[model samples]
Target: MMKRLAMVFVGLMLIVGNAWAVPDGIWKNITGAPAYSFYMQTYVGNAMLVIVAPNTETFWVFLDADDNYTNGFSASQDLSGAPNSLSITFTSDGSALANMTLTGQLPATYNLSRNAQAPSTGDSGDAPTLISPADGETIAVPTSASPYSMTWTAVTGAEGYIVQICTDNSCTNVISDDNGDWTSTGTSISLTHATAGFDFYWRVRADLGGGSYSPWSEIRRFHVSSS
Candidate 1:
């Protein structure tokens, strides 16, 4: 039997305009895996790419914007001819609107689509409630191959979330996040640590951008067993 592999790729481009800078790029409709349709404006310079895969979860990589025509930008990858490693490249000069060009086993590619506008500052809503470990339960330590699955309820109108794991109830010693910030785009995240066998306190908040965030949720406690 052949092994199954799944992957999703998204890119964003930001250009300096007028008195401010504008962000544009490929935005994937979060309609699960095995099927995908993206939205974007003309493909220019300064691109951001987000990759999602099993176990690894969500990751974002960016290419800086260049205003000088002489300074061109580029990115490269070697998929090693994997089933999903279909090489593709697209570009636009911004002289006119352009659509995405996909070359691979991708489901559908849009050639005359409109820009997928970014969300503006909206309601911050309420704090996200912690859902795993049962608030005082003990769980096995997470390994590099497998990690504790931290999860929580989604907040209304939330663009993202800030998660904090600590050693004490006061949260004086902060635990490092392996998966970056658990972005609100996804409700669950994998958690891991080099050393375990410790008690951990955690809390979460809603990020509304522009220096605004929802109040932190009530802290929850959990213990990572040594065995």
Candidate 2:
């Protein structure tokens, strides 16, 4: 009788373990992001998942290649619904996932391959703010100085910045500024190449370590009084 009890206990433990397993694998998006798609990706240890919304603005978390909905790697089966689209929050370095609502449409059945390509760049982080020379401020060009300095607040996770100064507000006409399209480790840069006495538009974007970049800060317009 004790032997039989022991056997049952072992079986129960196996069942519980299987029930609480987190799938550790790579899941690819069979369907490319739609033109109207809003997709998000999260990295959980060895597992990487992408959440995509192809049809509506409302977003959903990852749907495994086997058509199983991964509830943010949690062992929970409950899914929450909300009117607004869902987004995934991640820990620094893009490891460990969180803040998933788990309420979105499951994609049609698709095959998910295990342990594919490693996670590439484009991880999430807070955006950097632009500062200095104040927005829309006009600085008189020094009589004989060849360059003017621009500055911005440093971003915590950013390793460098891509600065663009344009002749137009839209940044289409790239101004001949320092090392045009230069990536700077410091917050400030001096532009010796741009033409003086013309109104110019400038913006900066943070390079979040890896190839990921924060959205460009609001464009600031500066005027160069003729020397």
Candidate 3:
């Protein structure tokens, strides 16, 4: 009989640590009703993991390869449709089954393996008020600055946001400013990178989890004046 050997790729050495499960929490019930299910929005990454124990239907979680561990080795689950919570356990290696207890089933995804995500929610018939830079106004990028930041009103239940820019006022299809085009931070994404001596138009929208986007906010235009 021949044994199968896994091929290890390069660059896997740096991040090749034992796969440890972060203890998010145990849940109680799964699959029953709505409005009470442990609902959460998570960014999917390299792999998707579903953990199951003795009872309850298996759940799903996603993780990215570029996550920075924060708030300790913790995890969370979404039980949006769960009528209650359930007890669960995760196993890696060289360990006995975990003593698990939880309510409101939670799905935990590792940030490194998951891209920070803002899901699109269907028209839930609710609107959020934005609370930063006035829309449709011309702003200036600090002279001689490598990066700049933009601010705006936050939409309710937004998982993430997308910022787009164009030189033409009537242009559509906004590109992500995540590549440092605008030098953004936190909930306020960046929008400072621009070709000098060019007038630019910009717009931003919040992405709620699932498959919904908030109505596009009023457009904003800024210019990168030449030195």
Flag clash pairs in model 1. Answer: 12-25, 13-24
Q: What is the lDDT of residue 166 in candidate 1?
A: 78
Q: Write the per-residue lDDT of candidate 2 for residues 1-227, one digit (tens) a residue.
A: 00100001101011110111123333333323222333233333333344433221112233333433344332222122224333222212223322232333432232233223322322334555677668777776733375567888888777888887787888888755334466689887876654557788888877764224566788888777675
Error of 1 at 202 (Å): 0.5
| lDDT of candidate 1 over 1-227, digit per residue (tens) | 11112223343222211011233432222322222222222233443232221111111111123321111212232232234534433343443233333455552333322224432211235778889867988888887688888888888766778787877897667766655544445666677663567788888777654323555678999988888
Task: Please report, in order, the local distance difference test score of every candidate based on alpha carbons.
Answer: 0.47, 0.47, 0.37
Candidates arranged by lDDT, highest first: 1, 2, 3
Candidate 3: where is the Cα deviation over 4 Å? Answer: 1-146, 173-185
**Cα lDDT over the full model 3:** 0.37
Using all chains and alpha carbons, the TM-scores for the candidates as numbered come to 0.43, 0.47, 0.38
Clash tally for model 3: 46
Q: Where's the lowest-lDDT run of ten residues in candidate 1?
A: 53-62
